[model samples]
Target: MADLGAGTGLFTRLLLSAGAARVDAIEPNPEMRAELEAALAAQVAAGAVRVHAGTSEATGRPDASADLVTAAQAAHWFAPEPTVRELRRVLRPGGRVLLVWNDWRGVDAPLNRAYGEVVAGFTEADVPPLATRVPEAELPGLLPGGFEKRLFDHAVPFTRERLRALAGSVSYLPSPGDPAYAAMTAALDRAFGEPAGGEAPLVYRTHAYLGRLDG
Candidate 1:
């Protein structure tokens, strides 16, 4: 399996936990690759997870080398056409491509709604909304076969500090020293006020799109 844009090996670790024979974590960012290597050092040393500094369009892997190619929470950053071509190149005949994202379900609750507003306020205009960016209907045109969608509902309980950290993790959001950073932090504090249990819920609809290439 090839896990593209495997930041910090989050999905790579999941694959390992699920008993995958091997996983190639391909991350283009130097910092992210370094973190992934450090986080999964044991797996790397055991020859279970291999780290590659590569992008979705140029994986630097042999033809038909992977049985499955996966991109989790990272496909939005890729050029769909080139990524699909690259996936086809690296995947064996009839191999599958899986695109997954933890889609925030804002309408589910007040906490979720507030979180969405906080994110939107901080998010740059160049960043596209995940909800509308990848239209499920158009996925089939990008690959040999059409794609199938699966959704799983889940929630993460976040304390105030964790929520702030989560907000800070948004790539387009202003950093600590930036002028807008203070404002964003202020808004987050207001939106994610102290809950009775000291935590708030962030719900997600895990979206999975699976497609297979023609042999």
Candidate 2:
């Protein structure tokens, strides 16, 4: 198995927990790869998980090295054709791929709408999801054999603090000490006043695309 854009090894950790014999965790950023290596030091030392410095389009693994390739919340940034070629190179015959993203498009929930407005102010454009902007991905593309999409209705509860963390986790969102960070957070505070439970639901759905990489 190869996990692209492994980041801090969030999904990589899940793969280990699910009994995958081995996983080649590929992440381009040195900082993130370091964090993953540190967090999974035992697995790395045991040779169960290997962290590599690479990207979706240029994984350092050998041809047919992976039985499965997965990208979670990270494929939007990938350049389609190169990434497709790389996936074909690294996957064994009939090996599978999974691409997942959280969908918030067209959502009109009060909290979601309010949050989108806040984000839009910082981005200086429409608040439509970046996932939706990717070509043939949110629906279908690279998978010439076609793919299966499974949607899971989900929601995350967020208070101001949790919301700040969530925003920070996203690569594009303003982070602490950024010029826009304080303003974005202040706007969020206004959009979501203190709730009874200190959190409110941000409704969204998870989209999982599963396909065999025969093509």
Candidate 3:
């Protein structure tokens, strides 16, 4: 199986745990790949997971080599047409491609709403929203064949500090040295205060889209 844009190997670890014989985790970011390697060192040494420096549009794997391809929370950065072609090239006959994302479902809740407001204040108008970029309705056209969509609901517990870190992790958000970083941090701190139980709920709808490629 080929895991494209396997940032930090989150889904790769799940695949390994789920009994995948071998997983090629392809990541272009050096820092993220380093972290993935460090976290999955034993798995790498065991020949269960192999790390590659590559991108979704050019995975560098031989044609028809992978039985399955997957991208988690990273497909939004890819160019749909070229990426679909690359996925098709790497996948064997009748192989499948799965695109998964953990969409936040607590937008209407108090803490989540406040957090959204804080992010919005810092987010640039030109940056496109992820959902619109990789819409479920359009996945079928983007793949070699049509696709199916599924959603699973889950919740994560996070403390105030974790919440702040989550907001800061957004790619488009200003970094520490940026002028807007201080204001963004202050706003996030105000919006997300310490919870009563020391942990707040972060509800998510895991969206999974699966499609197959023709031979």
1-215, model 1: which lDDT tens digit per residue? 99998999999999889889999999999999999999889899999999998999999999999998988987767777788888888998878988888867534776789888887877888875654336566566544576778889887888877777777776678877789888887888888888534887788788898887553
lDDT scores in order? 0.82, 0.81, 0.82
Question: Sort by TM-score, best first: what order?
Answer: 3, 1, 2
Per-residue lDDT tens digits of candidate 3, residues 1-215?
99988989999999998889999999999999999999999999999999999998899999999998988988777888788888878988888998888877434566767777888888878876663247765666556577778888777887777776786777788877789988888887777686434877777778888887552
Each candidate structure's TM-score, on Cα atoms with residue i matched to residue i, is 0.88, 0.85, 0.89
lDDT of 3 at 4: 87
Better of 1 and 2 by TM-score: 1
In the range 128-153, model 2's lDDT, one tens digit per residue, is: 45634354443345566678878787
- For model 3, which pairs clash? none
TM-score of 3: 0.89
- Model 3: residues >4 Å from true position, as ranges? 105-107, 131-133, 195-197
Angstrom error of the Cα, residue 152, model 1: value is 0.9
Model 2 spans > 4 angstroms off: 126-140, 168-180, 195-197
Those runs of model 1 whose alpha carbons end farther than 4 Å from true positions after fitting are 125-127, 131-133, 141-144, 195-197
